[model samples]
Target: MSEIVRKESFKHVSYLWDDDEAAKLAGDEVALLIYRSNLLGADLRLTNYGGGNTSCKAYAKDPLTGKEVEVMWVKGSGGDLGTLKKSGLAALYVERLRNLKNVYRGIEHEDEMVELFNHSIYDLASKAPSIDTPLHGFLPFKHIDHLHPDAAIAIAAAKDGKKITKELFNGTIGWVEWQRPGFDLGLKLKQCLDENPGIRGIMLGSHGLFTWGDTAYESYINTLEVIETCATYIEEHYGKTRPVFGGNKIESLPWEKRKEQAAALAPILRGFCSSERHMVGHFTDDERVLEFINSNDLERLAPMGTSCPDHFLRTKISPLVLDLAPDEDLSDTSNIKARLVPAFEAYRALYTTYYETCKHPNSPAIRDKNPVIILYPGVGLFSFSKDKQTARVAAEFYINAINVMKGAEAISEYTSLPRQEAFNIEYWLLEEAKLQRMPKPKALSGKIALITGSAGGIGKAIAVKFAEEGAVVIVNDNDEARLAKANEEFGKQFGKDVYITAKLDVTKDEDIQAAFDAGNIAFGGIDIVVNCAGLSISKPIEEHTDKDWDLLYDVLVKGQFKVTQAAVAIMRKQAIGGDVLNIVSKNALVSGPNNAGYGSAKAAQLHLSRLNAAELGADKIRVNVVNPDAVISDSKIWEGAWAEGRAKAYGITVEELPAFYAKRTLLNEIILPEDIANACFVFVGGLLNKSTGNVLNVDGGVAMAFVR
Candidate 1:
């Protein structure tokens, strides 16, 4: 006879709830619901960022009839429970929502079901309901909470999950097998409750847990109780002899060293993943990551499946593993690329085979056949996506999955939904429609941009514009105070993570190299480089000293070359071409008196841009120049002595000098910093993807500088 397992009690488990705190939450049910949802989301062990949802059944007065009616306030579609607000919940009439099932014919598709669910809303002002509304509606409870808690999923995904669940809950909790969430799953939940009338909750096998009560506190406490019980069971059974890799700790590389190593290999991985679409890479090496990557069974267990079924949408069914030896030197770029290229090809071939073998007749066309997560033996894990944020999100899910797998394997073997079932969730019509409904991203959504002299004036304006269009920005300037102010301003408008500030003097090759390396580490690689750093020196040829001539050339010409050289090396390795925009003056094309030092340097820089365009065109790198005559807004170049000299030459006061230059153009309009920013956007945003070796005049109408 088999030994009987004792049911574990959760008397020692701690919770975040306090009766005093609960009573002080605005004295309303919706506020309580939001609080409960946030409390659950705060603990990643309880729920992921946007994975779980909570709902409460309450009474609200109908605005039309002035009568109280039963309503369910559920988390709205696409709302993150971590930052949930009152506006994030949709209120629907209980009877109206229940009646949705009657209208659903047996032949209705997922899209048709979503439409019916939306029509069940009691108020037109409420947001759209979540896809799982019927699951909450059919259950006979006043308060319901559903979450994909890691501990609960660890139990639910075991090979003998039914046996383990009965032992832990003493048969007081009902169990339902895995089913795609829809009207059918709702009916199954109702059936489970009917069969086990005394059960407090139902555990959906390989999915999640559902608990309910008459009050929000009751439901939340019940959820914690069940989660605690599962955790205790895993502890008692698997906590003692948990498997470890070789039973010895591996001396892991430091984070800074890992980043340095990643800098050399990330571009090669990005190059392999790039096709018609570009891919950005992000690296992670937390404690949990180290445990998983250093495990003895990593190659066998990691590729089985995700911790939960919904994760398939973001992380795919499995991750691709690479053989990065511990003793190998990662700083060698050539050796790293030679190893990574073949691995990438093999992973793609495997994915193609999986897609052909598992896709259903109704499945949507296959997405890009590249892996989102890659595991390196010694270094760490790298996640790829269209942008940095999404890449980080994928990494978070993978980390959570690693933890859950460890817990499940401690008791029994881990199991996941089969390939066909995973494919059903991945290609669901309603989920696909959500992607379609999202507003189109800006033209440069996933690209990285580096701008020099971005503390003020045209450089600052261009930095703001690129951020608005969805590019991650690297703001560089020699002035520390001005750069700090720019950082604060950009952080307020966009997010703090949208841009990084660095002190750079473009004249030094070392400074140029360090700036590019910082950007490559912060983001994956550099995609756009704009050289707008310059100073003005207006004097006659004979009056100008050699010092003045060298200073002008060092900034305008030599500095531009150093920055471009560093950018091209990174771009060439990425093999995904980039854009280079140099902010020149109209003086480059049309010379003026007493402008010998400035004009000669500007002209040399202009020709250098043309030269880069000629040499880098075969690699798909585009180089261009934007020449503006006068832009006095926040202009440091036109201040003090330089302004007085230019004004005296124009036979006007300093204040009228701008107007004097404006009147010379055919349009007679003064150029602003935004005008030059717009022209840079045009070339860098791929509007002229095929055009290179070009100069655009932003001087309102400079006929002499205009290209035929």
Candidate 2:
């Protein structure tokens, strides 16, 4: 079956070319040059909505007076390439931009430095240079373009972006990880150029694409061709899954009505930012828009933080995940406005609290809370800026970000850096100054994770997953033999450093706290959790006693909650975000028969996760769920008399149980422990930093039985 793939999926640094034509391009024709810039600009596949920038050096007679001066016609910092006219471009002394990156060694005063950079630009446009001007300056080539291309970034965002880029670029291009995209990027790029004098292009992981040439057209054409290659590569490897938009569910509104809705929502959203007057882009991509609008959890899952680092200086992290429907436009902007002001205020409060919690005693002062982006349902996304350009850039970046998010969801899961980690990236001066930086989400080092019930199957898989990814794993189980078996297996498979086993009844308070304390002592702090220790009691409501309900609650719901509460104490004390994963069941959502106590307890577990999420969000604690179905593990109670009894009671043969279960899902497959482990990884790792109160269905679509 043909899968749905992102339209523009590719690697960025593949544009490195070094032929005779590239070696001698000073005399390239002007029309050719214009075409080149436009083609490079048209690489919206790699660079949509002018997200990337390009510059070329030229000697021109002053239009106002008749004096010749050499300057760079750089794409204006915030204009969309889709409609970037020549007149919209800015002119600054190339020598000055280069000197700024080169001569300015270590300027401490930000204001003074801004002033010095301004002095370098003789033109009175007063427009700020692209934050990446230093990157352009440091590159040896005369023609340069930098873009946050979707195609290129698709590869860059991968865990193996560097390895992929190396395979793609081989010896011709260089690669960097995602870094803060200004002076830091420039400095890193400067070093790269020095080290690889023959390097023709640079690919920044998790950021976007960069290409340069001696002439404008060469750089542009090379960027396009390379992006195309990367796109083909992605299509071949990760062939996309085409999730259809089941559409025409709602009536389409006329343009006049749409305009009215846009106007109504604009003013209130404008209040979130300093921009008084705003421009709103109304889109009818309702079917696609509503997918996210309705998915409260997706909002929680998305990196809703700034689309990129440059956006952070303007918008703090991201706008509140707007709660809305895809096709339903916000009819009352005023009401949303009322809701948003408080939300922004809350965001600011949380931001301040986070700073207090995480900042060192002698750290630099944190910046102010200035909102830059605001998301609205059915209306696409809004970028708020004092100028039309910044607002437009904001909108474009947001749209691209949403697309990337959508694509990421179809894959495994898309994650972002943790809030505190992002804060460090946003504020670290040394981190901020390197041009060749690719900012990685922090690794799982210096962190600990506890997996309850890990001695068996699902929990065991999750424990191994965490350990493989560098986190110290604490495996918990009530059964000493099973726990020891897990410890032995992990030690033999991955070595002793990866796994540690302890016996504990998750329901016991002392056991819960002791587990956490031991984990803290072992791994410095508890950062992740996988609560897979729930007892599944297969009994119909009539047959189930109150005692059965209580036991289910104690083991399935309260036990997980207590363990999480204990871990949270350590996590809060350390001031780092903590993640808790409740391994519930598809039976929580869907049921045939004989799952009363189990299902009810699982329902309670879901509620518990959400409550803790809301309560502990301020403490940087995240709580979510992994709903697994029909697992073949030591924890699979169906193997016991009760499960067989349920099958017989329901008039189903034991041989038909798995198939009977498989028919319920859109995808017919067994729900494996590794499947649960993958979803767990998203929750614990940097990817799902902002994700809380989420229910990830590891049930192979079986839960459709409930919704249907």
Reference-based lDDT, each prediction: 0.81, 0.62
Stretches off by above 4 angstroms in model 1 are 1-27, 103-112, 198-200, 228-239, 245-251, 326-335, 539-547, 639-641, 648-652
TM of each candidate vs. truth: 0.91, 0.44
RMSD of every prediction: 4.7, 24.1
Candidate 1 per-residue lDDT over residues 1-708, each given as its tens digit = 111211133343336565667889745787889888887777777777778788988888988899999988988887777789888888888888788777677534545776777666876777788777878889878888888877788888888888888887899888999988877688789999999997888898888899988888888778888888888777676546655422323555777776666666667677776764776667777777877777776877777878486566778888888777644576666777888778778878877777788777876777888888887755688888887777777888888787677767877878878887787777776777788888897788878899899889999999989988888888989889988889889889987557888888998887787787777766778889999988888766687899989999999999999899888888887889999999999999886888898998999999999999999999999999999878988877887877887776667899898889899999999999999999999998867999888999999898888765
For model 1, where is the 10-residue window of minimal lDDT? 1-10
Strongest candidate by TM-score: 1
TM-score of candidate 1 on Cα atoms, chains taken together = 0.91
**Worst window of 10 by summed lDDT in candidate 2:** 1-10
Residue 631's lDDT within candidate 2 is 74
Tens digit of lDDT per residue, candidate 2, span 109-160? Answer: 3223444556557467635565666677667677787876655665666556
The deviation in Å at residue 397 for candidate 1 is 0.9
